[model samples]
Target: AQASFSQVFMGVAFTCGAEEEVIPFFDRGLPVEYELTRSIRVVAKTNRKKIGVLNTEAKLFGGFDFQSMRSTPPWPVVDELKKQYDVEQVSASEPIEEEYDALLIALPSSLPQKEMDHLQDYMEAGNPTLLLVDPLTIINVGLSPSEKAGANMNPFMRNQGPPPKEKGDIHALMTALGVSWNKAQIIWDQYNPHPDFAHLQPEIVFVGANNPEAFNQEHTASAGLQELVLLFPGSLRKAADSDYDFQPLVKTTPASGSLNYSQLVQRSFFGVQLVQPRFGHRPNPAAYTMAAHIKGESFPDTTNGADSDTTQTPTRVNAMVIADLDFISQQFFQIRQQAVGNLNFDNVTFFLNCMDVLVGDESFITLRKKRVRHRTLETIEEKKREFREEQLKEEQEAEAEASQALAEAQKRLSEKVAEVRQRTDLDDRTKEIMARNLQEAEQRKLDALKNKIEAKKEARIQRSKEEMEAKIRSIQSNIKVYSVFLPPLPVLGFGIFIFVRRYKREKEGAAAARRLRA
Candidate 1:
């Protein structure tokens, strides 16, 4: 009966021109019901997932500006996120209306108890989330109420606010996730300095790839990042009781130290001295985790009786915690005239990569990764750079010397012509003839001098090129020689070893036979 059933299906598949599709069902002997279920699951997996941006307390998009829904300059990170995902602004006061796959919480100064409950509920339901927290919040103190409400807002307003205070609910959430957030301290690295923006405070921390302790190359989010500039970034550490797998994505250099914001503020203002020194006082300079990834078992669904089964397998939960929220803000991306939307930086790419990894959607990671194109020349060895500089200097000196010699030759020829023209002994006709001859002689000398200088310049350039090529060729030749001979050396040694062992064994066997015969 089974054979007959298979034959009937095969005939039907051939008639329907879907033999390949039917063959899979026949091979697995899957019922029609199972095939339909699998098809639905495949389609669901391919669909675009929604992302929720918590704007109620976080104000991630921007503060409560009724005129413009988005922040004045608008957050560039949101613009990038919209290109690939359906991003919806979610309020913590209301129940989440959209079926979002992930949530993004931009630096929130404060969250009410109700809002914190909503976030906790969302996270406990197994939804992935990314939290960008700031250790300090700077408010614009210079803007008046009228100027703030004006249509054209100045982007250069100076922001002066107190140090970042820890939000009780946010701290509780971090503890639950097994991540620790240092509320009182901010990171500063002496080894990695940033281009001074006069408007920004001295506490702003800048970290680059050159500072090995600051950049983690092992994580996917920060793998190819070259530099990250954080404005008053906080420090993060994993907690002992956390159940998730924790990995540091970004860090501060070994020269970095955590400064107490309260102490620094007292010293900056009020003319008070610190009781204890702040620099180089720690026993060991350690790299503090600036960003981290935590993954673990998801919360079980309790919406339905069947879903509430304790024996059911739990889903995987992924969350990314970044200490610096201002790093990805519009203020950081905008420099001078360039707007936040146009400027490309590693921080933006890193944020997008983190989002993609959290949601298990890597489709946009490659596209976003292409945004960072800055190639720093600092990677070149100092010796090689110095040699190149010396070559350039030699060329400049040679050109200067040739110019001086040409000037001297012209001056001498001009003086000789003047001497001949001024001679009183010569008659008018003779003087004119001698003057013409002298002018012609001067022209020939000038041309010869120009040619000589040109030849010298060309020779110098050619010599430099030849020397560079020679060095490159010498390196290549050494590599080639090793490539050709290195592999064969081991093989040759192994062959000789095997031959000697076999020869010795054969002789021993013959001697044993001879001894037995004797």
Candidate 2:
């Protein structure tokens, strides 16, 4: 207050390290106060805990791809880390050195023996780490070698999921961390229904752990998280009689089911399955763990080579494992905050909290990401939202049904083509010609079918939408009129009544006074 009003002031000053890159505090991932404090601390102590990000096929740190003809930037999460720590991509093939305070391994798979040993040693040493591995992600299938070289791989494209070989223990680091992830199964949460195929169906395949109770409320990493969206996440459970305690961080309600890995990845087969609920019938009801810590008693026991005959000793596995990578990917968590820079969920906050937990520094965990607040008309929006969701779900179900039909038709056509191609009587040219004709025919038929289904869906949705829109418009119009003029009507009426009563009372008093004088 004194400085604001008076001339006396202490000039502000901050020192930057000789090697550290200096930038405005706004770009620093921490809150202004924390960033100022951290900057002050850096002047005295230049050393900061390093955070290593092992790049996967997804290419976390993107660059201009000559092949894809696109320039991509690092994800917001990674960019934030770079501003605060010595963030760099670490290779799995190399020895795990640099003494990273925390390591984030995404899409890990098979590992070389040497890398495996290094990773095992690193985890056993009580380093905080987070692992995100997926068996079948709908995001984009693995990018082409050339495209990945350019670092412009798009994950949202519909294509075949990663091949078995690309998943060399999927970062080959998951196995080393003692985090058991099944490269074969994916969870399908039924309670929080977000169906992938909007086909006409009663069953849903998309997984969403949307309840607060499903989160480990006591843990700082997951506390206050109301929901987590996972596409096809695997369950985190103890591996085959392994006693290592699996403390769950995120869980699915009993209404969750597991889908077949191979069948789900193949588009046609998966679409067909979506059309028909195979897993939905069995309806396995268990609170499956989607994310957890592999630590304490459940840690794998290892015996020193010199003492082979001795009993194995347990080591703390200070690691947190999340089954799906998309939850943290730019598409899922950072979607809403992209354009408007407001009204985002706690996804990024959850990630930041996990990072702080792993890095053993809670300094920035309480600070939220950049956000802008605005007012919304709740009365109108509430009704509109209800209608909009219903309409979207209906449309999706219709699309799912259309997709299933197309898949079946294509499957039949493919089987027939395979049978025809096997015949040796026809020359290569004839076979090629037949194949082309059949594909053309298949395209025409599928397009017609898709159009037919789409038309129907649009017509139905339009009708429902029109009806709802009319009702909403009527309600809104009424609300507007009432809001404009109805607010003061009661007050106005009450004032008139009070005036009339007062007038009557005063007239009676004057008449009585006059009668007394006469």
Per lDDT, the best of the predicted structures is: 1
| Candidate 1: residue pairs that collide | none
Question: For residue 264, what is the lDDT in candidate 1?
Answer: 44
Query: lDDT tens digits, residues 319-371, model 2?
Result: 88877766667764345334233324556667767777888877655544333
Q: Each candidate's lDDT (Cα)?
A: 0.61, 0.60
| Model 1 stretches with alpha carbons more than 4 Å out | 1-47, 63-73, 94-97, 139-168, 193-202, 266-284, 298-316, 335-344, 371-518
Best by TM-score: 2
Residue lDDT tens for model 1, 1-518: 45543434431121122212222233222223433433343334435568889874335565654323354544767865764566888887765556677899765335555676677667656678998776654432111111111212222322323322223366677776768886667676543222234234335666666656556677777876766777667888887656667889888755456766564432322222223322222312577788988888644446766645467665455788888766776655453124333333467668878888878877555544543355544523233334444455555566777778889988988888889889999988898899889989898989998899878876985687467546645655776788899999999999999999999999999999999999
lDDT of 2 at 271: 29
Per-model TM-score, in order, reads 0.50, 0.57
After superposing candidate 2, which stretches have Cα over 4 Å from the reference?
1-13, 16-21, 25-45, 61-76, 94-98, 110-121, 134-140, 143-166, 170-217, 222-295, 299-310, 323-347, 369-518
